[model samples]
Target: TLYAVGDWGQGKGKTWTRAGGVKLAKNGNAYTGTTTMTKGQAITARLIKVDANGKTTWDEIGDVKATADKTKTVDLKWTNAVEDTVDITINAAADLKTGETLYAVGDWGQGKGKTWTRAGGVKLARYGNAYTGTTKVGKGNAITFRLIKVDANGKTTWDSAKDRKSKADKTKALGVSWTSGKVNEDGTIPDDSAISISGKGVADGKLSIQKGNLAELYVIGTQDATPSDAVWWSDGAAVAVSGTGTVYGVQTGTAKVNVKVGNQTATITITITIK
Candidate 1:
């Protein structure tokens, strides 16, 4: 359940009134409520969610168009406002253009993750090939993010590397080098997948296919790390992943596949679950 309230004006002229009850919708992760207000009130409203343990969270409602004696359905997604500080750095040498800006899109459930938007990206300051910025977050929250660069014209490109996860808090600067590929004659770099050395075991321990099914696993690699040679094999299945990094689920149980890329080899534990 959610508690709703409206606040208007301030000081002596301030007015506060109860909005109404808000219940969880059928789809879940959403709330619905009826708020009656005087037309053109210009009032600000908020919701306080009361959880099972009686712990309550506050969320402010965004702009909503309300009519006199009419119903309005406002959709909201919870976001912890960014208040923490952290530095981000990226290294790209394929000429990322002068106006292109690199941002770190993150918050894999660490701290309040609503800091970045697809329209504007992360709020990082660009310095040459690196970016520096910070957002205030709850203390000791683990933050994981991926790097994306946006050109002035709004064109965007993501780094080929996986999420840069950190155990320590953001007090320590975040850094990751670019895995950009060669530039084409049109002054455009290849896509992130093109730069990746397929089957770098990106999904190692992640997955491929279910039982009696075979699917190809993609490797997420950087340009600097060209793990060209890969040998795939399963522990018990007669079929194994060849140079294609494709695997088959021969048994209904779990199977472990080994991918040896250059000197480094990663073991992918696959659960052959067929629905």
Candidate 2:
């Protein structure tokens, strides 16, 4: 019998029977039969021999590799199954520009005998806000990555200042959001400073609230010795705020609130989850 595992259904790992008793091939070896897979989707499977009384005798573990076509076939065969663990990894893709390229360097690559250039760097494919790719690395390996953009005239731009860092493991899915747009020509990173509301109930940069719930928007930066005039605005019709920065949630949806303190302006995102 073959069993599928790892995010097959929902929420982390899940197991499902992929095949019953394996079919006997012409060479007498048992095969689990072909399993169809998509281009970017990955799946890990384990083969188990079951006795008549419903007990597993032997097991062999393996993973399916994605192909270039829209679909791929996977079949598992083992003459002598053994008990062991096999780690399967599917690298994530990022949403980025068309002309730009993503690269990863650190203990996972450089320390492992790879350079930090376009030829030696680990390249990631653009997948709509994510750059996805696959690499084999031991657990707990530290990694850092950067982006390079080359123009039509052969000029190149590098976003080396804001390299993202993470550890290599199943628990850590590496991802970074280019919320402030791409890197500039001079290599200076863009500022992503914005106003945020923090208090009793808030998570993931979003302020969750019910209808008629009162929330406060806090200024994130240090104020000057002299006070400046502050103005506040809300994009959603259901959201309203007083002059003192107290916000009231009137309906369910997302509300983008903007605050201007003298020459500086910042926006806060609020989500009205319960009406």
Clashes of each: 9, 10
Model 1 local distance difference test score: 0.48
Winner by lDDT: 1
- Give the least accurate 10-residue stretch of model 1, judged by summed lDDT: 195-204
| Angstrom error at residue 30, model 2 | 17
Global lDDT scores for all candidate models? 0.48, 0.46
lDDT of 2 by residue, 174-230 (tens): 333343232211122324443333232334455677766666444433221111255
Q: Which ranges in model 2 have alpha carbons more than 4 Å from their true place?
A: 3-47, 50-57, 60-99, 104-114, 129-134, 152-155, 177-275
lDDT of each residue in 1-275, candidate 1, tens digit only:
56554453222355433333334432323344444456545545555667888786767434233234322233344543232443322222334578887676777344673764554345455443334444444445666676677899988787787766654333223335555333221223445444322221122144545555555443333332223355566785634454445565666776676766555555657676654
Residue 274 of model 2, lDDT score: 64
The residue-level lDDT of candidate 2 at 170 comes to 28
How does candidate 2 score on lDDT? 0.46
Q: Which candidate leads the pack in TM-score?
A: 2
- Candidate 1: lDDT of 132? 45
Error of 2 at 20 (Å): 16
Regions of candidate 1 where Cα sits further than 4 Å from its true position: 1-94, 108-116, 119-121, 168-170, 180-275
